[model samples]
Target: MASHPNSSTVQIVCHVPDTLLDGLQVDMVLHSHAFVIRKTGSFRNHTVRRVMTRAPIIITTIRGGLANQMFQYAVARRLAYLSGGHVVLRLADDFEAQHERVFGLRHFNITGHVMYESKLAVTLQQLFPAHPQPIPEKIIVEREYQEFVPYSGKPALAGLKTLLFVPELLAWRDSIQLAGYWQTERYFADVPNLIRHDFTLKDPLDARNQAMLARIRSRPSAFIHVRRGDYTSPYFARMFGSFPPAYYHHAAQILRTRFGADLPFYVFSDDPAWVKQNQIGGPDAVFIDWNDDAPQCDLTLMAACRYAVMSNSSFSWWGAWLGERPGGMVIAPRIWFKSIPEFQDVVPDRWLKI
Candidate 1:
């Protein structure tokens, strides 16, 4: 089976002799089929059977840090699963050089594959030469040739041919190219087990993180994630501001009262100094200063904890979601974004929001 250069559908090419051509029958497998037959010679007949074995291709542009990438991947995975399509993760290269945002999905045990923008552009050029506008050099930039599906908190139509998810819509089409940080649990709630399996870590924790993981599992630990850095910047603060100090304090108090005052807090943060200065965890907490180079390690440690006090960041959100315990508590800020009004879907219904 070979994948189409322009579409996500895989072509199942089959060759049949001229003698058997009349009697040959192809069964409808997963979804649909596009059959092509050609005569190679006077006595020989070549039958090329192209079956849409996989769902329509959902090529989504993945950006930001690990958690954000996971969000994009999960949405695409669910969409593909529902529509019987394949997913091609288009990693945004512009952020790689500027923000050091590497395509970190490989670090997880995800089933989907990824393609570089340059390779996708070359494939498009070879496939669609008659197209007027060139594919944008940056995947984030809008182009007329691409079909972008806008999200407005509604389920997408069933019969869409080629849908592109830019932000708002939840659509199911034969083929779609999605681009959004779909932070809602509702998108993948039906396939929770599949997502949990896919999001598992590809590699085991290293010695340093493993030791920390042991400590996290040893007690009634509460994982507290403090996200600063980018959120504190003047421009980003307006849109994605840091959770106020009071939020953390309230979350800690709730966790302590629910669990126990002696419950040890495992603190994870991009800015360890800021966590130290703020004294977010207090005397009973352990500050995990290591694993700056390995962010997934931090996530693993966070999940290992029995309870969680998450930040507004998606990074911490995944930590809490993955590490969720049956009886344990997860406290999050009611407000996810400072500017956005419709982030109610970001947090799960079960998780408490202070």
Candidate 2:
């Protein structure tokens, strides 16, 4: 079972990179008493009323893509809940110590602290601190280029997290390589965060989600994810792939025949345009537009759905895993992305492979 912080006094440090701190600011503030500090001295004289040493506090960081950032957030949230201290993203000069060594870049003061996790409460309990030991530098900084992907917006995801444990990360890396295909390592190098905890997708549009759930609760509903991309850059273009339009169409057909047209299908995807061009003509299908506002929340909300139809992307993997409901059905491509098992593990055992 998960736990939560029970402290009142808190000290949060924004330790996000120079680039990603801004995007996640709102997410951090919502969870705890969070603040951005440029140096260690920033917290010099702050008064902490609570002092519970048994509770754990989190100072987390990571370097990976957006999917990786989501993983990091998931891990940090679980760690904080399990340990009792709120999660804090340290955003000070000293906080930049490890990042500068790993990335070999000198930029500091990244983006947002709220998006990934909340800062732990500032209390005397933290003075003794109870958290996982730090992962070594070798594991954290080895083979930097092996993890790069071609997505232009990768920095958005990479910048969204901080490094906490390096050994666990190295183990995850070694496992992916052992699975075969060196290229697979890059894509999955940062996936440990997903395994840390199960995410529960919430409704994106607060009012609409409440309204939709209220109505859908009275009847049957299905969530569909129509994926249409195999991200293969020029270097790895040989792996270029796209799912057959028939894949989604066939799944939709199965659901319609079994569940009836009266069931509502909430279509969640990264690309709405592609879905429109290829979606099965079903009156029950309702395409949910993310509106490009909160990408992280939109994805999480989709994952919250009990029923899902996933594509072959880590983005969808996290969502499907989180959204899985008891006795729910998840339909995914049997042969996903160049016939690679590395990319296919996103399909959990609960999902039906087509």
Candidate 3:
């Protein structure tokens, strides 16, 4: 017989001879000749059962923009898949005043559960004891990309529960509270099809976007994404600096060689004026600037293109991944960050890096 420390139940395992086990009653008696009885003590109030209940939920905090949010959700989804538990997204609204970021996962067709900060606090208090102020009987995993150096091949954390993920770490079968960027496909490569299904847009494309999609599919097309909003800032640039113009020049040359110089090219950027000022696009290139209010529509259009020349941003990374065509070409920058080494797992093996 075995018992769980935190549970109010007891399990009994026994083997009996077939002849001596005749007329055995599982509910009332053990056998016709012998009877089983329980002794009353500390476990008197406990109920004996054959199996245990379902595993606890794994709660992961969701932060950042659309692409970063996808990474966080993918990690939590993979962990839940391995542990046979559900995942609850803890929406990080603290940055709303500064970044003006809103929860964008609802726009997708994902079926996971989500909880706001107010409801998460209440649920945590009700489930666990009050001794632990924030979360009780839970593991807190934080992102430590800056301090923890990669390429060392060291374990990110020692314990199985509370962990700090630097780059990527395999999750064991345990309910944990995860908070990280998890900016790599290797973390959840086991469920790529499921993740793609979850990332599908819930709403249909509008008229303008549908027209753009048709244009993209009509002939040979290429997408060039220029990410330059926060990346231009001095502080942010030191970490995630903008890719040089030479990288784009090289990528465009490769696409032109593959699909001919007359191929139509679409330029997507946060600052279209910068693209115009630099004359980055070719003669046939069309600048996409009307979908500022609907960024997801822009992503959809990028995905419909035949080829992609991506910047060092998750937003473009997702676009290239989603819009990939059969025998299509995707060219990315060799260096993702100025300080950190190249994230080998972020870009797929098949994609070309210049």
Best by lDDT: 1
**Residue 313 accuracy (lDDT) in model 1:** 83
Cα lDDT over the full model 3: 0.67
- Candidate 3 residue-wise lDDT, 69-111, digit = tens: 8888888787777666556777633545534765667667765
Candidate 1 pairs with clashing backbones: 55-84, 55-85, 56-85, 149-164, 150-169, 151-168, 151-169, 152-168
Candidates' TM-scores? 0.73, 0.53, 0.73
Per-residue CA lDDT of model 1 for 1-354, tens digit only, reads 776453454556666565765433222122233333332212122444333443355677777788888888898788777766556677544547754766677667775444555556553333233333223212322232234323212343222222222443345544555565667777677788888888878779888788878877877788899999988999889877887667887889888887788888888988888888888888667899888778888888888888899898888898998888688888888888777656477888799988
Candidate 2, position 170, lDDT: 32
Instruction: Report the alpha-carbon TM-score of model 1 versus the true structure.
Output: 0.73
Residue range with the least summed lDDT across 10 consecutive positions in model 2: 173-182
For residue 197, what is the lDDT in candidate 1? 85
Clashes of 2: 34
Q: Assess candidate 3 and give its TM-score to the true structure.
A: 0.73
Superposed by TM-score, candidate 2 places the C-alpha of residue 198 at a distance from the truth, in angstroms, of 8.1
lDDT rank, highest first?
1, 3, 2
Model 1 stretches with alpha carbons more than 4 Å out: 1-54, 93-95, 121-173
